[model samples]
Target: MKLIIAVVQDRDSNRLSQALVWEHIPVTKLASTGGFLRAGNTTFLIGVDDDRVEKVLEIIRKNSQVRKGWMTPHMGGGNEGDGSYPVEVQVGGATVFVLSVERFEHF
Candidate 1:
């Protein structure tokens, strides 16, 4: 067995979950926060046979898309220690991992 973990954007969570379910894949969703923007995110846990690894990855790949992130105003352009450094950044991206599941139990 393999455990598939997917970290995705909040907006894409529902769509990704639905797509996984449509493919008859069961998953667990957990709330998460992004590192850069501290934005809300979703982490999905999927358990499947090793043979389905590729398929699961495909679903995650389709759902986990990179989106533009908000940025603050730029500071310290000329002034030193002005306490403001802002610029546009891209933050919405995703990561997926597949690990061996030696044992799994549900209560």
Candidate 2:
């Protein structure tokens, strides 16, 4: 069996969850926060057979998308303690990890 852990931005959570449900893929959603941006995120836990890993990944890939964002750094620039400008950043994507599970149980 495989345990899939997907961490996705909050903006895409609802849509992703809906799509997974539409495919009859069971998922457990947990509220999460991103460390870098301190932004809202969602963690989805899915357990599936080894052969279904690719199918689950395909669903997640179709739902989660990457987009641009802006964030200001805490450090000052140019010998001044105040030139903290917001920089365009890549955000809104899923970080997924697939792990082998020797045993899994549900109640």
TM-score of 1: 0.72
Global lDDT of each candidate: 0.83, 0.88
> Among all windows of ten consecutive residues in candidate 2, which has the lowest summed lDDT?
74-83
Model 2 TM-score?
Answer: 0.75
Residue-wise C-alpha lDDT for candidate 1, range 11-60, written one tens digit per residue: 88998999999999999999998786648889999999989999988877
Question: What does candidate 2's lDDT look like per residue over 1-107, in tens digits?
Answer: 99999999888899999988888889999999988874899999999999999999988887786777888766544555676778988766899999999998878
What's the true lDDT of residue 103 in model 1? 97
The true-versus-predicted C-alpha distance at residue 41 of model 2, in Å, is 0.2
lDDT value for candidate 2?
0.88
Q: Looking at model 1, which ten-residue stretch has the lowest summed lDDT?
A: 69-78
**Which numbered prediction scores highest in TM-score against the true structure?**
2
The true-versus-predicted C-alpha distance at residue 13 of model 1, in Å, is 0.2
Q: C-alpha displacement of 73 in model 2, angstroms?
A: 17
